[model samples]
Target: METDGNGSMEESRSKLLLYLKLAFLAMEPSNCLLSLAIEAGGGCITQQVQNFIVKECFAKNMKETTMNNQAYIKGILKKVIANVESSSVCAEDCLYEELAHYLTIGGPPEENNIIYREISFLSSDLDGKDCSNSVNLVAALRCSSNMLEGDTGCSLWPSSLFLSEVILSHPEMFSNKSCFEVGSGVGLVGIALSHVGASKVTLTDGDMSSLANMKANLELNKLCLDVASDPMHPCAQKVECRHLAWELASKAELQDQRPDIVLGADIIYNPECIPDLVRVFSILLDNDSFGEDKREAPSAYIATVIRNLDTFNYFLTVAGKSMLSVVDVTAKTQVPNLLPYMRSYDRSSVHLLRVSLLSE
Candidate 1:
């Protein structure tokens, strides 16, 4: 097909605009459009059109763009948002924290803050060796807090790094396994399981407030999901949420289900709750034959970025014989060093450990 000069110029603009829209859509779309607006290169387009759409969307009290239309609308708006990275405005801690802030159903940013998380994975498709992908997920537990009140600073803590490093190192351990994550603050690892096609994923946290926030973020990202039955709806994954407390760890059986894999992130931070967290993992792992997919020999993968060796040792000591092996997961690339954002007392202080379970 031959095109005239005007057609060629229009096509060029279309192509450039297409990339811009894709970038904005990639930013979480279900929540609010403030991030989307920031993503769409806010003032680039005919300012009148931008103002018209924003005003209309608000005038109608439309909270978010639907899942089915999100990518499409974003694609159309590409001309507006030219820079993909800018569309992903929520990159640094401030913006990242803001995205998380809206995803959380309730709670203040002071308690539920976002933190930089590092994760590495062993790719079977890549010849069974480890590859690393660093992304952020939410975490409820803090390294220095027992006060579990309405604190937004507690949104997504740095502890998410520990969880990500573990999953990245031992991706297979989670594959085809029924996984249940306790205290799933931001659910980074739990969502990661669904990404790898795990048998099932259930994210639980004691804090109802955090759980609500986690669910919002999960739905917002479409991370761990199943399809919506309605044709009018988009496909989502299946990730369940539950309220659980470590003090009641022994009551895990009460849920009437046992998970093949039990995971936690930054759950060992509070020294006072160390025993409870250990107890929770123990109960979740004790019955190997409980879940539907009872394998010949069941295993587990625990990832942690511990700043305090004493605390790490404490978790290991409390876990006792359950800790079969430990491998330190190192970053494959230095381009995105996690330490800068982690701000650990010692740069090497944040250790990513993979603790395997004893075969049962």
Candidate 2:
């Protein structure tokens, strides 16, 4: 039996290699062989073929079709992500070779194009299965950091499950509103918002590395940042990457204007930053006053994979308390209570808590 098992493992490895070769041979420059690999139960095989094609593209004079093919392979990877349910095509160093070149070589500039991005969901490929249980939204966003943070599942706000659910549920919330995402790591949520027409979106993150990446992603997607500070310009919907730390988010930095929507993902994991996060919320939400203009008070959304429920609950409790206190401190409007703002929906270890001044 031991010998038989070893033989089976070797056979599986051989079949995988054979299928990978077939997939590579089948994928002509314009043909749909890429799709065939997906249909042939060749998720891993497709990945290998993709890697090879990427490398070949780089070796063969740094072609433009390589970038287009990168997008194509990404589409297949999305299918692979959906099929596998728990594997990551984004290996630690396995960037689509074509995109790596574009990032390093630079692409066409569009300082006047609309920028769209999504935060952590699945990799839009086979990786989606890993977070199948969480709520994800297809939020359109505007920012340059869309390309900055690509460390697979590491860093802040890296998953798209929760954000996708939000955008699908509340598309109108961002349709014409000016949206601003704090700590827009990789500009996922912010970019998705821009994709769906948020009117104007701003992606804010503190890391310079992430900001540079965001710019590359924006350029890759045919979006660009404006040279002047014109808010009403046609390309205002395009994403802008700027450095912003929650601790330093003051009137001087935010320009004293609260956004119609404020969003964060995976920001609640750190208990030490809770106070700073709350303070940033207070200042950005105009002291948490929904007032008569519920639209004006800045609807806030946060999505986190609840690896630790204690941390999740802690954030809910803190958000509730802070929002109520802001209400009392800002105005005498005794409109809605805080407990009602703390309703939650659960999905396994991943929990969705809607915390705001508005009663659901």
Candidate 3:
């Protein structure tokens, strides 16, 4: 992540505070948060950090959060006190009291597992511009606790996070361009595209439940949902979300969308879906004009993590057979790491693939 390393001490502390608060809101592990606190305290968890936690982070979260994820917060408070005690420093009394309150609140863990994650993309050091008023873009989303349960699309993926950084870092690439996304999980990339001022965005997913959740997340980010079925009474929203099964996607349905740019995050993992995916891409990236001269084919940028070599190669082979060219642009692309506060996300592990038609 591109951090403000050369900034003044005050700026560094401000970043620490922001990072800590964002980590807490993101439900980061307590140990990860403690490390940030210790750095802010210059080797110890100071009384000032304690007060900030109690007054701003814990207090505000407790009061405003409607989710039943207090268990996570309770764990954080416990770890904070432990850290302070280990360092031979006395923690603020209010911190202990906050822990006590969480002790009293009890409920079924399963019922209140759903939560809204505030994904913030800090821009202070993104482009070397330090404007306090112009903070990062925070996209609030309602996500399920069990990401791998019935609906995996409801969960956030690291590739999406990486892709988000790419979109925010290089807004020029997406701004004023017609963008479409495949497997729009949690609708994070779509939100990033809209933030970058994409002229038109069309997001599609195969799963019905995920499609519903994607719409909700888009609305949560203040972007209205536009369905492709209704063209006459279109809303003011520039972003559109639709359900599209790759295996069932017809050529006509695919031809209707001729975006300047196509995007996907973590959509190439499944080996079973590669064929249909390549088919969809082939149709989408094929020549859109009927004239003798062929216009520029729409390009597709796909972000993925190379988990298994076999699966990755399978996707590449399938794309090659479908007359598509895929370039490994992970090192070539310059995407500023806007989400440094999110310690859980490993930006390096994510790779970028620049894909487009290789001439019919």
lDDT of 2 by residue, 89-195 (tens): 44323444434444554434533222322222222222223322332322223333223434321132423434644554456767877777776765656666776
Better of 2 and 3 by lDDT: 3
* lDDT tens per residue, model 3, 1-360: 234464666666766877788878777778889988888776788999898887768655644353456777888888889888888888788988888888887654665557667888888364334534435688887777777566678888999998988998899999988898999989999988988889998999999988999988887776766445544432345788889999999988888787788899999888999999999988888775423645566899999999999999999999998889999999988777787778888889988999988865
Best model number under lDDT? 3
State the lDDT at 157 in candidate 1.
46
TM-score of decoy 3: 0.90
- Evaluate residue 292 in candidate 2 and report its C-alpha lDDT on the 0 to 100 scale: 52
Model 2 worst lDDT window (10 residues)? 333-342
Q: How accurate is candidate 2 locally (lDDT)?
A: 0.48
| Per-residue error (Å), model 1, residue 262 | 1.9
Task: Give lDDT for model 1.
Answer: 0.48
Q: Candidate 3 at residue 346, lDDT?
A: 88
TM-scores of the candidates are 0.50, 0.51, 0.90
